[model samples]
Target: MKILKINEEISIKRSVDNGTEEQRVVVKSIIERVRQDGDEALKAFTEKFDGISLVNIAVTEEEKREAYKEIDDDLLAIIQEAASNIRSFHEKQLHPSWMTTDENGTILGQKVTPLDSVGLYVPGGTAAYPSSVLMNVLPAKVAGVERIVITSPPDKKTGKLPAAVLVAAQEAGAEEIYKVGGAQAIAALAYGTETIAPVDKITGPGNIFVALAKREVFGDVDIDMIAGPSEIAVLADDTARPDEVAADLLSQAEHDIFACSVLVTPSEALAKAVAAEVEKQLLTLPRQNIASQSIENFGAIYVTDTMEEAIDTINRLAPEHLEIVTDNPMELLGKIRHAGAIFIGRNSPEPVGDYFAGPNHVLPTNGTARFSSPLNVEDFQKKSSIVFYSEKALKENGEKIAAFARLEGLEAHARAIEIRLRK
Candidate 1:
């Protein structure tokens, strides 16, 4: 990790989305083929990218039962517990359709409606992330989404969905599960095939190919966000523990070679200690190759002249995950303007939010925290504005409404209001 002094200004260059010209072209071809050929295109692409041919694209009831059997009782119980927590948290975020009526017979409000259907893409080639299944599915379920579909790549070794992924999806109340993955599955979800139905929106993280596919198919079907590599920025002070900060940094770094882990502190001693601690801990990680590469390339420690400077630098970066290890972490909360999720104090590690903390772990990455947010129930729902006016009210405001519409050169709009008034 590089150590640098934060002078009058903060300049930390972050990595952008992973997209190559070749990947985009390949993904485009895959989407077009899926759109034109339908089920056959899905089968062909499954074989080509996932190295498995499937007679059925959907996961059957029998497969789900088998998956449950494969999972341990303890793990199932844990997943259920996590689901309960997630449900409780997201339930609070659920908003009801509301309207207000005035004595003059005017009604104004918003109609909150859940999406008819949603598609979740869980990555499943190397290791299955059961946690992701819970994080993505539970929110839609809480939002009252009627249909939730899951698409994950089948294991090459067994040609079956990972037992954990299946169990989690079932527990999270997924209406349908399909044995497919990559950009092809995204295309299938966007434009339905003979086997799978189209969805109103798609949400999840994937490889560069999946990211680009979502970008291409965004307008056709809504997408959560074009996520990039994982990142974490720890804002620590002298009172913070060096070992703990280092461990948190590596947690995100291990995600991928492009994942970033940074530390901003006002104490030079703490910065040096964290830098040393990170190097020592990197040796023991199973994903050391990936983490070390990430740390070497994108990781750094910035020593600021003051705590305010550190806070400013953190806001400038607008990291996906921000861990505040200051003596009074809460005191800094009001000062933080940009961060996908904040982990305050020593007990609140980044993984707490990632797994059991009841907050959505699917957050904005690649400095997108500046403007975006974590995936939640709102992502799976849409709202429509409601407007009503009595004849008396329209008569009272008719001229003003017509004038406002006419100001924009919308004579049709003005005449529509004028007609109601005249009536």
Candidate 2:
């Protein structure tokens, strides 16, 4: 990790670029084929990219039962526990449809409705994790979504999804599971095929191809977010432990070579210590090559004159994950303007939120924290405004509405309102 004195202009622009024109072009072609050829395109693409030809795209009940048989009892228990925690957290986010009656007998309210169906895209093969399946699906279930489907790539060797993924999807209350992955899977979800029905929305993280596909198909079907590489920013003071800070930084760096890991501190001594500690820890990581490349390219440690300066830098960066290790981490919470999720104190590391913590781990990345948010139950739900006016209420306000409409040169709209009135 490179260490430097804090500079506002350079620090804010440190994130690596995530776009590639080549990938977008390929994704466009894939989406077009899926939209035109339907099931045939899905089959051919699956064989071409995944190197496995599947007679059936949907995972069967027998396969799900086999997945249970293959999974260990302990792992299944863990998934259940995690799912329970996730369910409890998201259920609190559920809100009922509300209405209010005014003095004039006017009813104004909002009706909350869950999406009819949703598609979840899980990365398959080597990058698959059961936790992601839980994070993406359980929220939709909590939001009262009626149909939840999953699409993941099958393994090249065995031509099957990992048992852990299947078990997690089942536990999360998904209605159907499809053996498809990549941009092709995204396309299939956006525009339904002969076998798979279309969904109202798609949510999950995947490779660059999947991200671009989601971007292209956004208007046709709703999408959660166009996520970039993972990133973390640690705001530490002199009181913070260097070793723990180094470990937290590495947690995100190992995610991708483009992943950004940063440290902002007031103490020069702490910065040097963290830099040294990171080098020491890199020796033990299995993904050291990826982490080292990420650290070398996008990672940095800056020494600020005071905590306020550090906080200012963090706000400008607007990192995906932020860990605050200071004398009083809570004191800085009010000062933070931009961050997807904040981990306060030494005990609350980024991994806790990534796995067992009740919060969603699917967060905005690559400075998107400035405007976007973590995926939540609201993403799977839509709301409609309800307006009802009694005859007396309409009589009271009808003239003002007609006058305003006429001023806008909309005579038809004004006359429509005028018809309800005597004059």
Which pairs of residues collide in candidate 1?
Answer: none
Q: Give one digit per residue, the lDDT tens place, for model 2 in 113-148.
A: 999999999987755689999999999999999999
TM-score of 1: 0.97
Model 1 Cα lDDT, one tens digit per residue, 131-192: 99999999999999999999999898777889999999989988599999999999999999
Candidate 2 wrongly placed segments (more than 4 Å) = 11-18
* Per-prediction TM-score: 0.97, 0.97
Runs in model 1 lying further than 4 Å from the true structure = 7-18
Q: Which ten residues in a row have the lowest lDDT in candidate 1?
A: 9-18
